[model samples]
Target: FIMENCDELMPDYLNFIKGVVDSEDLPLNISRETLQQSKILKVIRKNLIKKCMELFSEIAEDKDNFKKFYEQFGKNIKLGIHEDSTNRKKLAEFLRYHTSTSGDETSSLSGLRLPHEGEPDRPFYYITGESREAVANSAFVERVKKRGFEVVYMVDPIDEYCVQQLKEFDGKKLVSVTREGLELPESEEEKKKFEEDKVKFEKLCKVMKDILDKKVQKVSVSNRLVSSPCCIVTSEYGWSANMERIMKAQAFRDSSTMGYMASKKNLEINPDHSIMKALRERVENDQDDKTARDLVVLLFETALLTSGFSLEEPGSHANRIYRMIKLGLDIDEADAVEESTSEPVAVPKVEGAEEDASRMEEVD
Candidate 1:
């Protein structure tokens, strides 16, 4: 019974703790594993977990101590929140993350998004990547940040999955900046102007879609970009490029299982950029022009790379880049002349070499 209670008391998240319970009063048939199924043992387990949670709550109230403790075992706490449905909400309150607002400090994900006046509805925006700098520098955050949105930087591998499990916090939807359904408000004139621009670039968007048919779900004018020429965004229900990259890296993950999550992404072109304007003019004038087609392909591929999506054909991308460089240098395809080899130097005929060989053959 004592061993059973002790076993029950240790929470899964605290499995790193090791201890032994000894007692003389034990039935010969009752094994250590058998004692684990005891009803009374279950009660002890629940009580122990409750007490630990209370203690953690108290520690959380103390910011310095909690920070120190979190720095040590925060990953385990996040894991517990992910695995333990019963205590997920409670564990989540204890979670902390880094945000643009915090600078070097950390803040709770729920507290990051506060109702601000004169701002678009601030859904809890987050950007996930391999590192904090990667997420910070992501094209995904560029316009969002300019538009006054606070983005949570999730650098850990488990961060994206945790956000997925969380879905929402404190009445705000946790929306990834890289995912679809991003909307921004515009004035009537701005809206009218964009509609006109859309019409103007309709041919360009169509040609872009055709060029990237297999690589992208579609091409459209971007409402999110402020300065970037283009970026990629996933479908509303599809996995972010970051999540897809993470899942694909798992050695045991099934590729077939990822099909639904790894759906095609939309390429968003910033109509305000000169490149977009030039491409539009070119497409409108001559969609079939090889230079315009090459530019479209290059832009789509550059957007793919910058938007965190891995290229399906890296060699092709490199070749396209090489062609663009050659074009920039005015080096025509025919200008790539192969190096000449010196005519094979005639082996100096040794004086009487054939005569010596014939004499040796005769001697043999």
Candidate 2:
């Protein structure tokens, strides 16, 4: 109807909209300016949204057709969701994503939007990282998926902020499992046990924080960690590791402000991990051992790297590693070797041919 009636009068693209343009009982002779500013435009927009949502619902019902449509216009739908606040929920229905559970390839939106009791009851759970493989294999999502949760693999640079803007969808919250404010259930007994472990590791945490030169906001024991000894987590309302990676990858990154926007990470040590347990014991028993201190620094550096943060002093980290290796080899710390200094051999200047000839003539 739009093309037949308005094609000659409007842009070709605008004519592509397939809908009836009704302006209520207004007079047909109404002025163009009046018609353009009428309340009917809003009503038409609302009706258009409803119609689009209905079309999307029909498309979503068929898996194969939905996949084909998503292949052709998924990005447009995602952009619509990002830009149109009123139709976000409708547009989100058509968006597809790659998931950890669905192998490496992309899957339909319905697959990830479904609910599971063991998994988070939210409409969607997702993780963002540098790449699909990184997000899929992230330590943060390991436990979430182990319980059969379908986590959306967000590899795009804009995805994190886009998801943040979309706090909820269809009465379901969009949960980021990596955020520091993540909600994990814990029994009273478990809470008490964690607190006790925190107390035990308090001194070690302090030493690490001090040696780290305030790079981390704080250090605390984490229950989220299972196998890893330590990992970095941002504070509430701060950029996640994935967001930080994205910001850094930009061509013209504003380091000073981005440094501020990139939340100061907190080093979360897993008390249950052998490395943390051993470090706690060593800090208490052999606190004076230089080797133990080196180990602590190494652990901090390793966590920084894993969390997608750069080391403040890479040279110091290398030196600590070298010292640790030297100690392991039973080498003396004070062992001195004489330095070798050799001067560069100078190239002798050749006499000019003209000067040599003059000299020869003088000699003759």
- Top-scoring candidate (TM-score): 1
Candidate 1 residue lDDT tens string, 57-150: 8999899999998888888787787777787778888888888778998998656766366553557888888888887888888877876678
What's the true lDDT of residue 300 in model 1? 79
Error of 1 at 202 (Å): 1.8
Would you estimate the TM-scores of all the predictions?
A: 0.85, 0.74
Which ranges of candidate 1 are over 4 A from the true structure? 1-11, 17-33, 36-39, 113-121, 339-364
Give one digit per residue, the lDDT tens place, for model 2 in 205-231: 887787666677888777777777888
Top of the candidates by lDDT: 1
**Any residue pairs clashing in model 2, and if so which?**
none
Query: How many pairs collide in each candidate, listed in order?
Result: 0, 0
RMSD of each: 4.1, 5.8
In candidate 1, list every pair of residues with a backbone clash: none
